[model samples]
Target: MKLIKKNTERGEEKKKRPKKLKRIKNANPSVVLDRHGNIIRRVDGTEHGDEKRGGQFLAALFEKLIPPGTKAGNKKQKTEMRKKPKRKAESEYNEAVPYDFPGDIIRSIKNTAGDFAGIIGGKSPSAGKAGEEKRGGIRDAAPIRKLSAIRRKFMSLSKAMRRIVIALSALFVALVSVCALNIWASGFRETWKAREASDAEKAALESILDEAFADERSEKLRPLPYRTTPAKLDVRAGAAVLVDTANGCVLYEKNADRLIPPASLTKLFVMYIVFKEVEAGKITMDDIVPLPELSWAVNLPRDASLMHLGQGQTVTLRELMAGLAVASGNDAARAVAYYISGTQEDFVARMNAECRALGLKKTYFVEPSGYDENNITTARELAEFARIYVTHFPQSIEEFHSLKSLDYPLQKNLPSWQKNYGDTLAIHHSNTNPLLGKLDGVDGLKTGFIYESGYNLALTASRNGQRFLSITLQGQGKGTKQGNEGRIHDGTELMEWAFSTFADYEPGKDTSLVFPVPSLASKGNDGKFVNLVPAWKNKITVPHLFGSTAKDSADAVKVVVDVPPYLYGGVKLGAQYGSVKYKLGEITLETVPLVADRSLESAGIAGRFFGTLAKGSLEKNR
Candidate 1:
């Protein structure tokens, strides 16, 4: 409580108390100790311990890296490290990291950092006015940022060529693939060009035969009237051909390509067109005739054959067809033409169109009536037409061409004005076909003879199911009787020869003869096999006797089925898979294409790719 003279009493106690230590200004924050634990740098009133130095890694590294020997005997270096630094160098070196390390690393790459970015440009912060020391440490005049020699060398080679190498490799692969595809395409192009050339050649050959056109001053196609030929029978006709209807095989041919005037045989094609129209529902045999003045027998030449048609006659198309077929009447032909197409010119145009459509190159018709010689055809071409005619209308033989005779102008054929004049008006015409009753199984076709063209006949006869079409043209003689006898004799010989030589056979039709093709069958077919059949009827006409009198059995013929070993998926329906060959000893008689029975889809990308590998392995194993 009594506080009198406090300052005087404190002064008296201070004289007896101990003295306190004082902290110095701008002194070292740490003490540098040598290995013996002796302090090199001391600071007043501070206790230094190893604990604080434990966290200062740089200071410890510097102490180990900087030995006493690198410090020169120069008094200036000693003074610079100990004294307080004024610029950035002093604060940077305050840590244990050496400031000269950058210069030591970059000295081999660059001698100096002259005019560097605001620092280390040929001078140091701690250097004296004389010059900077060039020792291999951070003291050299270097830029603020420096890199070693290895790092600078790496920067110069920065552009990598890896992407370029990869691109070139890809281009090389594509070029190789394109070259392979081009080679394959070239082969296909060559094959296509070859086919085109073959077709062009065939068309050219046909043009030569078609040169004997109507109304032209050309010579008749005459190749030896009596040729010692393959049929072993001398034919008196200029051109003749015997073709088996079963398989279209030519049994005998002699100048069959020669063109000649068809004469009355042109009616055969006229009847063919009429039959086609009937089949197409365009006309019927019961159609009434159009009795124009051009159709009356009065307008026709007196020598022209007729059914004695008069004006105001009530003839039907059926009667006209019979008259044209059996009587070979020119009047009936014009009348029938007018009945169907309004004009003979239009009907002739239709005939020509049908001829071209049927691929008969040498057969040309200027008029439907066979009384004119301008109607021309070749034996081979007529035979081809006869084949199609029979194939389309086999019944035409019984209905029209095979009739023995046609009697017309009866009560039914006469008009109402002449109904009571039946017997006086009636006319009888016998069949003009010379082979009708003379030859057995000779139903009909037609016979033609004109002054300019000799006798011509398109004859067909079927003894068994096998049939042969015989075309005999230009049977030359002095008169119509001689010409008629020649053609009839030639036709009868050819028909008999063909029937006895070749037999019609349909191969691979028997269910027991089904051919198994290994294809996509394993993948989709339940039976694990695809059944391949002939693409066509596969009917072959071959020698059943070969000069023998007896007919042979089917077992005597040899059938060879040729097919691929295996088939993969993606096969199309009706695609040709192989072939079936009909053989006789060493000779191959006929070959028919065997086609795939069904279509199959692709399995997948992976399945296709691996399937190819498996196929290769299969071949190798086989």
Candidate 2:
């Protein structure tokens, strides 16, 4: 009965242990993890028992040639070793071997294993060569009889069957190699093409002049390509431009530099001044508008648009802005101007001051509401101002300009008017912007129609976070049948072309920057790293790839940061310490400047000494 019990226990132990691998034999000591018994990867990230490091193709090839038998450890001592705690030296199991490959030793093993494999496949091996070479403990240990047994067994088979198997194996390997090469080459080609821009593309990227900016020190922007205008686009306007604000690339332009009246687009600057005042806490959106007698509905010109701010009517700054933007009301603009400044003349001066401040060299205003045809700006200048305006006050687009219609004198604010007629007196006025809902993504912006300026629309739209700013001046429309035909045609055609042709590409998602600094080598700090920052906004407009981060389509566009491994002493603030490269896979698309976050100095005696060492190390890395 005791013998039966002992036999049963032995059988259970054999089942608990795994079956030995049929093809692999351990040539070196294999890892045996005690604490992490089930995890495939160890703490340092190398796979357990995976110490062999060499060429991938060679390693995979040699793995199959290893014989089945493995050298055994002392079974009794192996069991006892598990009870001992892991030592400091044992914990660094992955770093035990250096990362470099073994040269001659590995080559010798491959020769021996390769010859043995050749024999199995019916190819004759050079006699005595396998016996002459025994490399680094890996040997062809099989005797001569074993070779005879393999040859005889192989000869007993059908030769045609063996040849067919060999052909299939070779074909499989060839197919895999071809597939891998195709994938690699495809990515390489895209990167190469993106980096190699054509002569036409270079002409398209020429910089615009300082006229687009109000401030001389502001960041420069290129509105449109100087050359290579899109073919087949027939835009008939006195002046016109379509620009992507993300990378500031111009999609289309016609007489962009020609001077023309901005029409009601002048209200854009008035609203800009008001928003700036509001942000500075000088005024609030709820402030009661100081209504002047000249701004009254009865006093405004007969054909002019009006918000109907009648006697005893109370209006807030917010309501007037909505009316000014939505109705293109001359009364609302006059009242807003008077409320913000004492008189229309003073307010117009402020508008001109703001224009000059912004660098609108060709733009000046004599009146606030754009009723006067003499107020001037070019298509290119207006486009630049629109970009700055939208960037400065993004919320105004949704709050005021985007309203589809304006209902004047709401009962709550118009107590006197509402008390007389209640809700019946409130009049609905449609937004002056014609492109609002008729086209996708159209939002708030001002439009004007005067004999001096014809029909003008400073249009802006956004979809999926990509925004376009356009200025169309002097649309030729005399009657309802010809109503804003030029402006509408130019706006729709250019917008559709821009959206289809180019999209914004955001850069510098993850710099993946790593640098080492010698200790005590930096000013005011004892650490071994310095902080880094980008010198400019990480956005550029690219064709047909919109709203994508670098991680999404890395093959089309990626950002590579080349940071030095060590800092040689301290760095100055805003210095160009390294570079940020925008790449399409392996090829660089554009290179921008990268700067240090703060100033660093080699302050102390110890710092200077270590800084010298750091300098030597950094030079070697370079």
Taking the tens digit of each residue's C-alpha lDDT, what string does model 1 give over 42-68? 444345444443226434544553444
TM of each candidate vs. truth:
0.59, 0.60
Pick out the ten consecutive residues of candidate 2 with the lowest summed lDDT.
205-214
lDDT of 1 at 584: 58
Q: Kindly report which residue stretches of model 1 are placed more than 4 angstroms away from their true locations once superposed.
A: 1-229, 509-518, 521-529, 544-547, 553-555, 605-622
Model 2 agreement with the true structure over 1-622: per-residue lDDT tens digits:
1122234655652223444423323323232233323223443346755544334523553444333344343334434444577564522432543322223223444456656775575444445443344333333345344445344433433687457646765786798876664553333222112222235532332222122222222533474322344646777777888888765566778888888888788888888999999999999999988678888889988988787877667889999889889987888889888888888999999998888787778999999988888898888888888888888899999999899998886676565535767666888998888788877898958788778888888888887788888888888887533646666787888777766666666654454432222323666633344544445553666554323542244336667777655555666545666777776555454566555544457667776774554454345534
Among all candidates shown, the one with the greatest TM-score: 2
**Model 1 lDDT at residue 573:** 52
lDDT of 2: 0.66
